[model samples]
Target chain A: MREAYHDQLGELAEQLASMCGMVGDAMELATKALLDTDLAVAERVISDDAKIDDARARTEEDAYSLLALQAPVATDLRTVLSVIHAAESIERMGDLALHVAKAARRRHPQPVLPEAVRGYFAEMGRIAVDLARKAEQVIRTQDIDLARVLDDEDDAMDDLHRHLFSVIMAKDWEHGVPAAVDITLLGRFYERFGDHAVSVAKRTVFVVTGKMPGYSSDATDL
Target chain B: MREAYHDQLGELAEQLASMCGMVGDAMELATKALLDTDLAVAERVISDDAKIDDARARTEEDAYSLLALQAPVATDLRTVLSVIHAAESIERMGDLALHVAKAARRRHPQPVLPEAVRGYFAEMGRIAVDLARKAEQVIRTQDIDLARVLDDEDDAMDDLHRHLFSVIMAKDWEHGVPAAVDITLLGRFYERFGDHAVSVAKRTVFVVTGKMPGYSSDATDL
Candidate 1:
């Protein structure tokens, strides 16, 4: 009973990791859609929402079955519960990516943001994909150390976020109303996207360490 | 053992409900700030983020400790996890409230949205408060019927959201771009706030039903 339970539980774990992998891929596509003004990619991400929704359901079911049948105790039970909660977090991340994708669609042929500021978004996209991939690695290998490093990556994205904001604010006064609104909304969404990735990282730490945040509880000190 | 667990878990449930109540209050003040151009209220919501963050943390710790201590099964386990998850969602709702607050701060007092449209935001706020209150009542009484009704409230919010967009698009084409961007972002954040409230309602269903959305088997949807 124990072995069979562990096997199904492991299967659930692998499924979650793969879901992370898909979000990583989706993030890549989202950024590419932004850069290339590719409607196809944006549409794909939009349609993929149902897919993420489905994964969430399955993980919840798997978690339930494991608990009901195996009746695990102590640390093992915490681990299972953590993974289930973590799955929900990742689903939200995917949902946010789709929101970004929809934003991309709304912004057809993509007006160019200031070049210096554009670099910040590029860096944010990079950090996001890395965070997603790191989340996958953390789940598959249960690597706490790598998850800790993802912690710093969140800060880097945050810096980029602040930088983008200051630049946009400086431009807002000069560029008039339309520019101000665009920069504000764009920067806002980008900053929030970084927040979602950080959330995924936080959940990864929780799953591996049985702690809300592995090393630092205050990831949003900025 | 079961009785002792219930006592501990009951407190957690109350905290979860309290968190939602706080979010609902913040949302009400945020909409008032936006509609009335009350910078003070906007500033209040921004400063109130720490309170929301604290609520989220305290509620989360409560849920985690219950799971760590009680060894709850089936519905009980689901309830604990769902509350933990709902706290996170409620926190996000607070974040959206802050989003509107920031947008309000950026705008000058003059040139408010039309009366009919402002009514939509007001209605949205009331519905949000209602759904949140319903969820809280369900947690308090374990009334599945109340939870079920809140679940339906999500569809209502979706419909209202569509109306919001059309209203904005109509005014934009009709009134021209004068004050368009601010109104657009305001509408956007209001819709998002409603969406998060719907998410909390969905978790309430999870707590009661043990049915997690069941979207697809092969999709790995997340």
Candidate 2:
């Protein structure tokens, strides 16, 4: 019974790591769809979000079962609770990717991003995928060092987000208001993707270190 | 000891409901700050967000302690877990309000909304406050009917969000790209505020029914 309980806990971590991978793939494909205006890929990302949500539901149920059946205390209990928190954060990462894909689909056949601003989005997407991958690694390994790396990547994403804003607000912006609005929201989606990754990392840190890193303010701040 | 555990559970509900109230006050003041361009009010909202975060930390700590020390099973365990979930949703609502307040501060001395679209924001703010208040009531009462009302209120928020978009995207929109961008983000903040409120209500419903309401999709969709 003891060993099985530990196995259930390990399975929860595996489920969470899988979710991170799913969201990473979603963001990567959604970015490609946005840049290439591929309606098919965008649609795929939108449809795949359901799978992530299902995974979250399954993980939460498992965590609840573990708590009720095993009555884990101390670090074991914290681990179960953290799994629930991290699952929600990862599910939200999937939703952010869905938003990116929906943006791509909404302006199908016409690129959501302007020519000059495409590079910023490409970099942002790359960082977002990287953050998601690292988040997966952090969850799988409970590596505090890797989790800390998400913070730096999130900073890079934030810088790219600000740069994207500057470009949209520039006097010579010729794409006009509609495109600007799309870019503003798209940029926000990518930035928030990074934030949720950091949030997942923070939850992992809490489980491992027994102390929350930077608990005063979350990464979702505007 | 069981009585003490039940008391702790009741305290958790009270803490979460108070958090809902704090965020409700924050949104009301934030909307006032945004509409009036009141820097002081905006600044107050910004600073007060720390209090909400602090409340979350305390609530989570208490909940964690209860789980660790009490080792509650079945309904008791689910109640503790739901409190954790609702605290997160309420804290996020507070963050959304903080985002609104910051937007107001960023455009201080100049109104964030143009005169033409001020009515939309005023209504959005009113609805956001209303949602938060109802969320508080739902947490306190755990009334499924009241929880379901949040869904209709969320629908109202979505319609306003769409109408706000149409206004901004209108050909006669004279505010230009920058204002459009601000309004886009500000509009999104309020919409998400409503979404989180609905999320809180859903968690309460889950606690009452032992099943997640609308578990397939969340209210955060674009």
Candidate 3:
């Protein structure tokens, strides 16, 4: 029975890793769609989101079943809980990508981003993908050091977001309200995607160390 | 021992309701600060958010403790899960309110909403308060009917969001990029606040009926 429970736990980790891959793919494709103004790619990203949501729902059900039947305690319980949190975070990332895709679709035939801000978005997209990839690695390996730096990695995205704001708020800014709105929302979507990626990493750290990030030094091990 | 667990569950419900109340108050005050350009109120909203975060953390600790010690099953388990989800949704609502406050603070001494869009924000604020209040009541009463109708209530907020977009996209719009960015972010904050409220209500409904809001008739009850 114990072996079965451990096996299920392994399966849970695999599911989360799979979700990370899917979300990473979604973000990459969505960013491409945004940068290229490709309606087909954007539509694909939007439609592909259902797979991510379904994966989350299934993982959550697995978690609920494990909690009910196995009644995991201590680190086992935290592992399961962290898996659930990670799944949810990944799903939110998928949703953010979907939002980006929708924004791209909305501005089809005309790129949503003005040329001046496109490089910033390209860098933001690169940072988001890097974060998602690192998030996947942390979940799979439970590397505390990797998890520790995920937040610092997120700072790059934040700086990019702030830079995007400066571009929009520049005195010589020429884009009207519609383009400004698109740029602002796009910046936010990328920044928040980074946040959820960091959250997944932090939750993994909590599972391994039994210490929540930014909390007290005390470990709340069960 | 069973009675003690039941009591803990009751306390969890109360904590969630309290969070709902605090979040509603935060939304109201933040909107007031934004509309009136009141720096003091904005600061208050920003400072008060920590209290809400502490409350949610305490409530979540209580939940983790209960799950660890009590090993609840079936409907009891579902109830605990719902409480946790509600707490998270309410916390996100508080964060949304915080964003509004921050936006107001960023634009301080200058009103964030242009005159033409103020009415839409006013109505959005009212809807947010109403939804938060209803969310509190639903948690307190477990009123399935009330929970079911919360999504419909969200429609009004969505309509207001769309109307605000129309105002932003109007051909004669005079607001510069900064104002447009502020309005776009502000509108999204309110819209997402409404979404989280509806999610809390939907989770409540699921707790009551063992049915997900949009899922098929398959009953996954334990």
Per-candidate TM-score, first chain only?
Answer: 0.87, 0.96, 0.95
lDDT of each: 0.69, 0.90, 0.85
Candidate 2 overall lDDT versus native: 0.90
| Each model's DockQ score | 0.20, 0.68, 0.41
- Estimate the TM-score for candidate 3: 0.95
Candidate with top lDDT is 2
RMSD of 2: 1.7
> Candidate 3: lDDT of A89?
84
Candidate 1 Cα deviation (angstroms), residue A61: 2.3
Candidate scoring better on TM-score of 1 and 3: 3
Once superposed on the true structure, which residue ranges of model 2 sit more than 4 Å away at CA?
A: A215-222, B215-221
Tens digits of per-residue lDDT for model 1, B47-118: 998898898988876776777667677788777777877787788777777776676676647535666577
TM-score of 2: 0.96
Q: What is the two-chain DockQ of model 3? A: 0.41
lDDT comparing candidate 1 with the true structure: 0.69
- Please identify model 1 stretches exceeding 4 Å from their true place: A1-12, A104-121, A162-189, A207-222, B1-11, B33-55, B68-70, B98-123, B141-186, B206-222
